[model samples]
Target: MSTSSNSIARMWRTVLPRRGSVARASDRFQAGLLIFVALLALAALPVSAAIGSETYVRQQGESAQQVSERSQVAATLLADGPDITVNSRAGVVGNSRLTDAAWLLPDGTRRVGKVVAGQGRLKGETLTVWVDRTGSPVDPPLRGAGVVIDAVVLGLGLWLGALALLALGYRLAVFSLDRFRFAQWQHEWFHQLDRKTRS
Candidate 1:
């Protein structure tokens, strides 16, 4: 038989309580507990997915609201951006650098503010900036991709945490069972020795 089939057969023999089975009661209990934990893990899949779906829906709505409240505008840099070497030496990995810039508000008024620009950009260069209705620079709106990623991370993290707990419980159960089996063996050994000495 195949290795997988042999393993399945062995598991079944260990879990099934049958007459004349050489397996001890503790062994059968451990096997049964393992099967139960596997089934519980499978059952948690749908629950985790549901939680993820709910989180995605709620965050997607929030993202949509943010997009509506935010607008992107072209900002003219007023000063030279940080040098590329300085940015790299400062452990800044991305192209972003804080620099003074100016952009037009919705009311046609010009607003000067510190905006994030690419490193090595010279004065008068234009870059896209996200701003609120007051023409104040703000972080970019959350994207759909970010919402999905958050949901996936939360769902997977919860599932993994649950698996860790289940594994811990299994380990504890096995430890207790091992202790019980050892004690039983010691008692049987002494009983056999006593009977031999009496006879």
Candidate 2:
């Protein structure tokens, strides 16, 4: 069995093309794939990065922090809601507020409320809650959504390119085959024609 396996393996190697050719093809495909990926990555990267960076300072992380800190301070400062006033200059709302903020109720134990901030405008006053610690996190864990879109776009490009390349490469690879077949047919046909002419 081992002898047969060895013989078959040797035969396979003898019949197969050079290993270097396969490696070269793999390298070419890798280079092409990198180009395809870089285009998408370049477009998505900046937009997504800008959004996250802005959100950290302006929206998600900071808003919560400020509100929480102030709320803690407010609870300690005034005692009740009738006179509790957060001012205009405090700036942004929503998730950007500080994380750790809880109210000290009159009794003793800590009570939790949203970071309470009122936006001040020249016209009027608008109060906003920057952080709702009550709710679950807004960020999702695993994503299967835009990936499908990207895959479809990238896949279509790859498939179409592959088809065109195959068509071209097939013409390249089989030029010799076409010529060999044509030569064989021409030789046989001419031999018959010559015989007929002589007779």
Candidate 3:
């Protein structure tokens, strides 16, 4: 038989009590616990999905707000950016640097500030920059792809963490059960020895 079919048959034998089967009470309990863990893992799926959906919605709202508040403008570099450095072991380094630049605000007023520019860029080179209402440089607005990725990562992480906890609990329970079964066997062996000596 296939491995999966063999596993299923073994599970059935352990989970279901038979009239003349050698399965012990502990064995049945362990099987029940295993089934319960599997059920809990299945139940966690919908819960994680719900949480991820909520996260996606909330993040999309925030991203929309950011897009509304931010503006992109062309800025001209006023000075040379830091030169790109090469390392013997790291190859090319310093891909970005803070450089003086100027851009026109919404009101047609010019604003001068230090903005992050590509390394080795010379003066007068133009680059797109994101700014807020006050013309202060800011990070670009969050994208839809980022929101989806965040939600998926959070959901997957939560599900995996739940599975880890369940597996740990099952292992601890099995360890305790094995210890109890060993002690019971030891006690039975000594009791039979005592009875034989007394008789």
Candidate 4:
């Protein structure tokens, strides 16, 4: 049999009951299975890490490209936003409000949109808003080490979770084997005691 098949056979042999004899095969099988699962999980960690690192690099590059492509333009608030006094006692609730505003594009064309601003902003107050080349508002993208950190965190979390699960499975398997053995021993001891008492 192949190595994997042999290992499986060995594990199965340990779990199967033996007639008229004590069976310790299950313990061996549990131990062997635990080792196998541990090794397999360990092997997967590197692959996951590599994939995560690659994802980080890709995201970092994309963010940098966005940084280069996106531009911040000063847009004026066309009118006062929602009243700040509405929730003053409750501590600033939804401090930003959308108000109509206008700004000049790089091509000297006027662009008007609803820009977010402070609740009590006066008319023509300058607010910095990010925009893409088409003058459409966009959120700033993460860059540099931020992408790297996020990727590492995600990768490590998944890898650790996988390892932990494998270990837990191994523990449960071992516990099951121990329980079976204890039951078997108890049965034998009771049978012997009964015979001795009858003699």
Candidate 5:
């Protein structure tokens, strides 16, 4: 059987028992808790998926709109910008500092702003800068991989977090049941010993 089928079978075995099987109060409660957790997780799956999909759709739509409303233009550096800082903490690279720059708008108007540039870029150097409908230099819009990545990350993170909470709850339930069972066993043992002594 496939792994998913195997998992489903195992879960059913846990939540279901043989016909006419007897159980103590603690055992029944534990079983009920297990079933509750399973059902809760299953119920949350759709909610999480919907949230992820909604976020992706919204982001993709916004990204497309931004792309349509924005354009990249070459801007001339007006001043020497601060050196770009390259720091890699977890496989992510980022550039820091924006240089004073000016670019011509599509309507033949000049726009001035601080635009991102590489390290050691000197005055009179030209760099590509994104501009919005207003012809103001603006940050680039997110697209493609970024939108999908964010959606996946959010979905997985929420799902995994919920699973972790459920696992912890199940462990606590089992611990409580085990303790109750042990106490019951001890009580029966003591009762049997007392009866034997009296006899």
Candidate 6:
């Protein structure tokens, strides 16, 4: 199995573009590590979201944005269409027959509507909005899956970093012990050499 795997790896090396082989391998390893980390973070995202903390706050914000957009579109459409007598609140105040366009804000109610560019007055059928201050929903919304992805990625990085640190620490400890052993061996050798010279 090992031989076959080695042969396959050699085959891949031959097939791949000839550049700096070491660099290419390092780059590939780095890319693989990054992908691994991302997957882990993704898995962790859900757990974080489940806490119903900042995640919930952000979700609510997105929802509000979606609602607001819908409301704006509704208002704009109200002026665009003919008055619906069946629905009293559906249509606006003036005949929003928009041939030209203009803006109006004589009162605190700032509005732009169909009016001649040079014309003084602005006019648009003011339709009664049943829901006021309604915010827009978060389109392309983030869900649990997204949350999970985020968490998994974060977790993966932490895990990898920890593993790396452990490996490094182990290497350092081994190196220190080896150096101490070598010093002791060298001291003993020196003493024997001196005794032999005296003899």
The per-model lDDT (C-alpha) reads 0.90, 0.44, 0.94, 0.82, 0.84, 0.47
lDDT per residue, candidate 1, 1-199, as tens digits? Answer: 9998997788889998578889988998988998898898888888888899899999999999989999999999999997765454677554667899999987799999999877789999999999997889999999999999999998888888888888899999999999999999999999999999999
For TM-score, the strongest prediction is 3
Model 4 C-alpha lDDT per residue in residues 1-199, reported as the tens digit of each score: 7999997676555556456535466665765687689688989799779878888988988998999889888898888877775555777666777789888888888899988877778897898888899998778767777898889988898898888888888888878888998999999999999999999
Rank by lDDT (best first): 3, 1, 5, 4, 6, 2
Task: Determine which window of 10 residues in candidate 4 has minimal summed lDDT.
Answer: 14-23
| Model 2 CA deviation exceeding 4 Å by range | 1-148, 172-176, 197-199
TM-score per candidate: 0.83, 0.24, 0.86, 0.71, 0.76, 0.34
Better of 2 and 5 by TM-score: 5
Note the clash tally of each candidate: 0, 13, 0, 2, 0, 37
After superposing candidate 5 on the true structure, give the runs of residues whose Cα lies further than 4 Å from its correct spot.
1-23, 84-95, 193-199
- Model 3, runs deviating above 4 Å: 190-199
User: Cα deviation in Å at residue 85, candidate 4?
Assistant: 8.7
Q: Any runs in candidate 1 off by more than 4 Å, and if so which?
A: 86-95, 190-199
Window of ten residues with lowest summed lDDT in model 2: 71-80
The lDDT leader among the candidates is 3
RMSD of 4: 7.8
Deviation (Å) of 34 in candidate 3: 0.8
Model 1, global lDDT: 0.90
Please write out the lDDT profile of model 3 over residues 100-121, one tens digit for every residue: 9999998999999999998889
Error of 5 at 177 (Å): 2.2
TM-score-sorted candidate list, best first: 3, 1, 5, 4, 6, 2
lDDT for each residue of candidate 6 in 99-150, tens digit (9 for 90 to 100): 3222222233534333211212223433323222323211234455665555
Error of 6 at 10 (Å): 32
14-93: candidate 5 lDDT, tens digit per residue: 45656775656566677678889988998878888888899999999999999999999999999986665657765434
